[model samples]
Target: MKKLAVVNGKIIDVEKGSILQKNLFIEDGKIVEVSEKEPDNSWEILDASDCYVAPGIFDMHVHLRDPGYEYKEDINTGLRAAVEGGVTRVAAMPNTNPVNDNISVTEYMIEKAEALFLAELYPIAAITMGQKGETLTEMGLLAEAGAVGFSDDGLPVENAEVMRRALEYASLFDKPIIAHEEDKNLSGDGVINEGRISTLMGLPGIPSTAEEAMIARDVLLAGYTGGKLHICHVSTKGSVEIIRWAKKRGIPVTAEAAIHHLTLTEEDLYKAGYNTNFKMNPPLRTEEDIDALYKGLADGTIDAIVTDHAPHSKSDKEVEFDKAPFGIIGLQTLLPLSLRLWKENILTLPELFKKLAYNPARILNIPGGSIKVGEPAYITVFNMEKYTFTEGMILSKSKNSPFIGWKLEGKKKFIIVKDKVL
Candidate 1:
């Protein structure tokens, strides 16, 4: 029996919203005990003094660009970056070159991640064939092949009937249809949020209504069909109010706010003088949107926080702001950036972990989110160590992030995934 003990740590009880100083004992990848009792000499010890031990973060929204965009980020490099960010499980978005719309691509991603033995990878299959937003893929077969959920993340399902049918169909498998809520007609050729900044910069804008309108439609569809719905990268105040109203009406819906959306705004983009790194889909909205996101999070309207960790190669982002792809690499900065929420008292420690670790697991139906006996021992140990986020700190294949020079806190000391310590 392989035995290990994590000692001298402040273990977070996400359920009770409390912390306890306990030592965690693991035997053959399963947590065998959680107490103050010292382990015998036979068991290996992993010290966690002065650090908080919580369940490994499960980032449900990430683009690991493998099997096609390896130049940007393959599974190996992506998973390594995930571990570095204190994440143990990730749900990869389906926007590969051929797209993960079939069983083969789904299985390939799972097998590749398993072989690496790094952070667990769950594939989110495409909602439409080739993600064209018309015909639906064989979601049942893809789910059977190990797809945890379905999504057309990089694109929105444009047809209302198609989306309604998708919601109804996905409900059959009890999987969430993660909607990338955007109306192409409203956001045509837009490069940033539709407001003062865009007008001043002479750039087209992606109106907040483009995101809000689709979210409203989908939430209503979810209510009508009783299908599970998870909104992706919600960035607008109106979007939050819509989701909150949906939940009040008892719509089967959940939502996430990206770290960038929760922190940065279009004003930051304007300040940066049209930096492409600040550019992303559902482009950063106004500070008013950020405040609403916080309110939504505090009130439980927003269910989780995600990185939307889209990575683009240097060559891919070295273009004019409008010509650049919409995303910035975020795996390496997720922890520190998110820790700001807890440090600022926007959320308590357990509340933060609920969004970072617990909620993602619950939303994706994955086997993680807590530390307890008889559970898989996937834990992240970290301290509130201040540090500057630099290019050297990024472990991702791509070096495209706006937070490269930001000073941040919360460093991961070690992450225990099953029986392996990283």
Candidate 2:
């Protein structure tokens, strides 16, 4: 590959926890040099003036819905949306038509994604076969087939014995078992969060206990079996408390908070007139929960910020509030919404990037989150400014975001993956 220079940008290195105004020189898809003075006329220069250049964003949780619900999202469109949001890598969930429990399904997704070549995709195979929480999948075989981790994301592994066995098995391979952390009995037929909003709206509620109880069980299991346990979309204060306690005891546990959970509260549902777009699993929590989540992120209890980029067709989300499916398309809004953390003084710029880029990569044990010399040239440039988000700007096949017309801060200007500018 030809040498390329990204110049005149404030480079933020999360690994170093430092930000500096410097130029990066890339050659053969890897960063070869960083300098204060630009190289001679031999290099192709990409101007990044008035913007922040950081490691390419890595979203550890996203549902591509390929090989099954392509109408809602496919590999091509979903990856394109990831580029628009400054994400160069993502971990696709396994809850598809034929769940990614076997090696053939995992190989299919790997080949299809390699053909697209827009972003690096890591497949997270299912923990339980068919996601029924009954039998465990072939964990060793799936991992050997390039699965970065294991998770039955859309559905929590409900049986404690099954979960314990799955974690013990996954530990042999040093892979994390990402838990969805919900008790079906506790969440019984509940559509929204169980709190004041659910009461006022006259809708069934999913209490915070539903999520906390499951997290508590999983934490203990991780401690008992020495398994790496990762909590997905942690949305409750009590859940944070349990994970924090587990970490204090030196248990191998890590957790992630979704962008929506950190930014929106249950009150947003009432303000938006009960828009179905705001609904999601582990639904938009209370303000206290949001505060705890932000605090968790600030203190490193929450290891990363994930999109949980669940997409649905308009037909799926346009019905009555209770009838609508749970989830919202979030790929395009991840950067803008996460920028709110820095804007609100919850985390500094470098600290925020640590959660967005380095932390997730470290948890998944994947490449492409550093801007150091000899690292692959995966980078994102964004201008922190005021802009309005609109449905027309959405690049995903599904336009199910709640931030459609909202004015937001920060916008990505360029996305470069493996030396190819997108």
Candidate 3:
């Protein structure tokens, strides 16, 4: 086993909320020690001064677009993008062409990722077969084949009876049924959040109620079935309040606030007479909603900060605003944008680390989301400084970014894991 030591770093103790000056020694891909003193001259040393050493980010929501749709994104490029952005592990959504609803597809994704020796990538299988929401997937076997969780992603199962049974069956495996909470009926043909912006922009509106209605139903189903429920890309304040209350009532519910939702608003979509690049689903809400998103993160109403990093081909995004695909490539920009929160004094460095890494690991039952000694040596070294973001430089195959020229703060220096630099 190779041994390497990172020297002179400000380590973020997420569990303790303290920053310690320390050096970390890694052996056999695990952290053997973290000490205030430097290692004796035998091991390879990586400089970490002026960097905040913390656990690598674990993004619970992302679309690698492999198995099919390689033009949009593939396993290798997606993983490389993730590692480059300081994410060591990710749970890739299974809303691909074949959909990860069966054991063969699930195994294929897991095997494909392992063969590449890329970042730690786990697949979240589709909750319903083919993601049609008509028939349920083989949850038990899917979990056995290494599906970390289950989600239909872009399509929410609108039938309450189907969701209830899925929850009951999925609970037997102790895996979370990650729901994309949206009432399709209420959403209709809406492209962005239903509000004054939608009306002014002459676009159909997807009211916040579309999201809340589903979450409200899922919370009760999860409560009734005793299943763990995870709500993805929670953009509305009403949903955050529901999740907070559900947790208080002993419901096994967890929710994530996307990076964009915490930073941008629907007003950015008001670039007059322009084609849309700023549009995204759970469409960016008002500034008031952004504040609520931050509040959710601070008060523990939101359990994690997910990139919701959806990638689409340029041609797919070139169409009209209402017709174009709804998403953005956030994997590479998640940390820096989120760091804007830290630089602004909205959250301490340690607090941000908790939301980005530790807390998600706990809820997902993953072991790599910590900077603790003796754990797997998955860490991100980052620089907290002013910088500008650009699109073509993104490591992903797609270049669809809403924040393409944003002046952002903080950037990742390295993604360290498996006794090697990724």
Candidate 4:
């Protein structure tokens, strides 16, 4: 690949723990140098004067329903959505029509993703066979097949012994056990969060203890088994507090607050008579919980932010809000919502990049979260002043994003892959 220079932008090296206003030189799909003095014209220049050029964004949790559910999303369109969302890399959840439970299935996903455009997709294989939670899948083989991590995702390993074993085994490969964290009996047939909203709406409610109980148990399991545990799509204030307490006590635990949980409250569920878009597992909580989610983000209690990027068809979410599938698409809205946090001064821009890029990359052990020399040329350029978000412009296959038609500041202008920028 020929050398190329991206000039006149604020370069934020999230992993390097610094930012610089300079020109970046890329060669062979990796950063070769970063210098303040724009040198002689020996390379192609990508104009970035009005943009913030940082390491490509990373989403540690996204459901790119592929293989069995191509009608919803495939590797092709899912990746396009990822890049359009400024995500250069995503660790996809294991829940699918036929779960990615073995080495062969995991390998097929890796092979197909390589033949596509947009951000890189790293498959997270299922932790159990069929996600039944009875027997553990072949961890070593799956990891060798290029599995980024392991999770049951939609289904938590309800068996404490099974959960404990999954964590212990995954530790051997240095991969984290991503727990969905809901006790089966507690969340069974539960709809919205167990609170006033559930009572007011006449919907079944899942107790916050449903999530917190599992989290508390998992922290104990991690402490006992000596394994790394990561909590995904944490929604409850109780879940947040447990993760904070566990982390403070030095348990190997990290948690992420979902975008919707951060920005929206139970009030959105009541809007339009309990909108289905507001329906999600660990369902939307009260204003106090939303405040706690923000507090978690600001105080560094929640280690990262995740999209949970679940997509359902129009028919899927068109059902009654009570019966609709859980989750809303957000890979496209993560950055802008994060910008809201930044604008409120709850999180600095560098801190925003750390949650969106750096910390998640560290947790996943991926390498695209920095602008340091010799790192892969995964980068994103965004306009700081252009505050516009239009509907149907997102590149994802399913347009079920809750951020639809909601205006947001900050926009990604272009991205750099290996030899190309768009």
lDDT of each: 0.92, 0.91, 0.86, 0.84
Q: At residue 57, what lDDT does model 3 achieve?
A: 85
Candidate 4 lDDT tens digits, 1-422: 58889999999866565667899999988898999867577788888998899777888898989888887788888888877877788889888768999888888888888877667888999999999999989989998898878899989998899999999999999898998988979888888887788888898888889999999999999988989999988887888898889888888988888888888888777774767877888788888888888888878888888899888788888887767989888888887888888899888777888888778878877676778887888788888654556666867777677677787888888888766675
Q: Which 10 consecutive positions of candidate 3 have the poorest summed lDDT?
A: 269-278
Clashes of each: 0, 0, 0, 0
Q: How close is candidate 1 to the true structure, as a TM-score?
A: 0.98
Clashing pairs in 1: none
lDDT of each residue in 172-213, candidate 3, tens digit only: 888899999999999999988899888898889999999998
Summarize candidate 1's per-residue lDDT along 233-307 as a digit string, tens digits: 999999999999999999989999999998899999999997899999989999899999999999999999999
TM-score of each prediction: 0.98, 0.98, 0.97, 0.96
Which window of ten consecutive residues has the lowest lDDT sum in model 4? 383-392
Best by lDDT: 1
Ranking by lDDT: 1, 2, 3, 4
lDDT (10s digit) by residue, model 2, range 1-422: 58889999999988778899999999978999888987789988899999999998999999999979999999999999999899988999999999999999899998999898798788999999999999989999999999989998978998899999999999888889998999999999999999899989888999999999999999999999999999999999999999999999999999999999988898998788779999999999999999899889989999999899998999999999889999998988899899889988999888888888888888887766888999888888999878899999999999999888899888889888886888
RMSD of 1: 1.0
Of the two candidates 2 and 4, the one with more favorable TM-score, higher being better, is: 2
Q: Name the TM-score of candidate 3.
A: 0.97
Q: Which ten residues in a row have the lowest lDDT in candidate 1?
A: 363-372
